[model samples]
Target: MFKTHFHSFAIALLLALPVAVSAQDQKPEAPYNAQLIVRQPEIGQGSPSFVPSPQVRGMKALSDGKVYLVSTDNKQLLAYQGNRLAWKADVVGSCPTVVGPRKISKVLLGPKTILVTVGERTFAEVDTATGKVKVADGQKG
Candidate 1:
């Protein structure tokens, strides 16, 4: 009898998993007060050198308290819970230099997915949870 009850309970949990996951996939609602601030670069001593601040290529705040950020200098997608860094995923084929046109230019947040666009043509669909690239460079997954 205990084994039968345990099996039924496990089945019920499995059925509810999708619902929980789907709810977590939704984007954050309006009145989002999270501001993206790119501070001005500070110059060092000796000779004036230009330091690059955090330039937001794309940013998205989810309803599940996850804030995703992509900087112009770094071609990696960063996930943050509050001020702490949660995870980061590199944008496929992206270079570290901020000079070229190959950097991530936009980030679109969908109901169930996040899409990162490079330049004007390449699009990478990234997973919200694991930061994995599901589809890249317009390739179907």
Candidate 2:
């Protein structure tokens, strides 16, 4: 009787273990065209609000739940953990445009960095944690 009961309990525990582990191992949803609030007042209005100018120029999500992006108007590189903003930096020399020939094309994820590209060239190498941007030669796409 003792042996049978022990075997049944062990089997049940093993079957339920996977579900429990998977639930805890799930990652947060990656950021994608998420509307982020800007502190800048639009047209010198009452208060700072979400504006259409500083849109998400490019975004890249990592497997470790980090999302990196570039702003449309100022070309600011931003990093996010889960839904919270981690850090931000100015992407110097980045040519960002909404309706022009030279525009921000895409964002790529590196080993520990994020690459901001325009047209068919990479322009910035941003650190994943500190949001430090190192200007790259616009050679590789």
Candidate 3:
């Protein structure tokens, strides 16, 4: 009886996985120019993989027509140049114990960089042109 109940519970949990994942990605309506930065992966039947979709959380529009989009689904920061994806980085966790998406509080603009706050003291400056992380505190460049 225990084995039978375990099997049923496992099946139920497996069935609910897809629904929970999709619901976690549901987000509010995007901006008028949201189309310019959205990414949709083509997933065929029976592929059985996470499609790396963005849970569009926040976006910043630059004066030069560039766009920066932050995704919590995959912990990524994507840079776009006029509706085309320039580059994307998997900013999962900058430092141990400070996992991304949750640690990140604010995204700011500094000259030609997008500053992603890691904590009260640390931040990562993503180059708007190259999409590379350049730490400001003499650590990385």
Candidate 4:
């Protein structure tokens, strides 16, 4: 009777040992960052105003403090100087009008030109000097 009772108690203890070890090894939940804000302002008298939407896709700010936005949807490029939109021009060729894949891949600013690339195709000198677009072969289009 003594041996039977001891064996049963030992078996119970062995079964509970793994559960206790796992509980001790469990990790606590991670804390979230408090700096990010996503909620839109509620409709009220003194709420923060939103900026007017522009017809552009990927927006990039230049070193000259000019904001450049590409409208893949409209097949055009735009430039914003200060709070006012300064320029808008259509991109050459049959490219995706929406700002996504198959659109203008990259934009580079030179002393007097802006270089734009779409996939493997490249446009070397888009003259920004007189707000004119010149193709790579040195012809105005």
Best by TM-score: 1
TM for candidate 4 is 0.42
lDDT of each: 0.59, 0.57, 0.56, 0.48
Estimate TM-scores for all models: 0.51, 0.45, 0.48, 0.42
lDDT for model 2, please.
0.57
Q: Backbone clash tally for model 4?
A: 4
RMSD values for the candidates in order, in angstroms, are 16.0, 13.2, 16.4, 18.1
lDDT of 4 by residue, 1-141 (tens): 999999999999999999999999986532211121112223342322112234223333333455455553534556655445677666544333323344455565554566665434534345553445566432222
TM-score for model 3? 0.48
**What number of backbone clashes does candidate 1 have, counting pairs of residues 3 or more apart or in separate chains?**
0
The model with the greater lDDT, 3 or 4, is 3
Cα deviation at 102, candidate 4, in Å, is 6.1
* Worst ten in a row by lDDT for model 1: 44-53
* Segments in model 3 whose C-alpha atoms lie over 4 Å from true places: 1-56, 94-103, 119-121, 136-141
- Candidate 3 residues 1-141, lDDT tens each? 999999999999999999999999987553324743433223332221122234444444534555676665535677766546788865445444343344555566544777766544456677878878766331232
Q: Candidate 1: give the clashing pairs.
A: none
Q: Which stretches of candidate 1 lie over 4 Å from their true place?
A: 1-60, 72-74, 94-100, 138-141
Error of 2 at 62 (Å): 3.7
Candidate 4 Cα errors over 4 Å, as ranges: 1-63, 94-102, 137-141
Task: Point out the higher-scoring one by TM-score: 1 or 4.
Answer: 1
| Candidate 1 lDDT (Cα, 0 to 1) | 0.59
Clashing pairs in 4: 72-97, 72-98, 73-97, 73-98
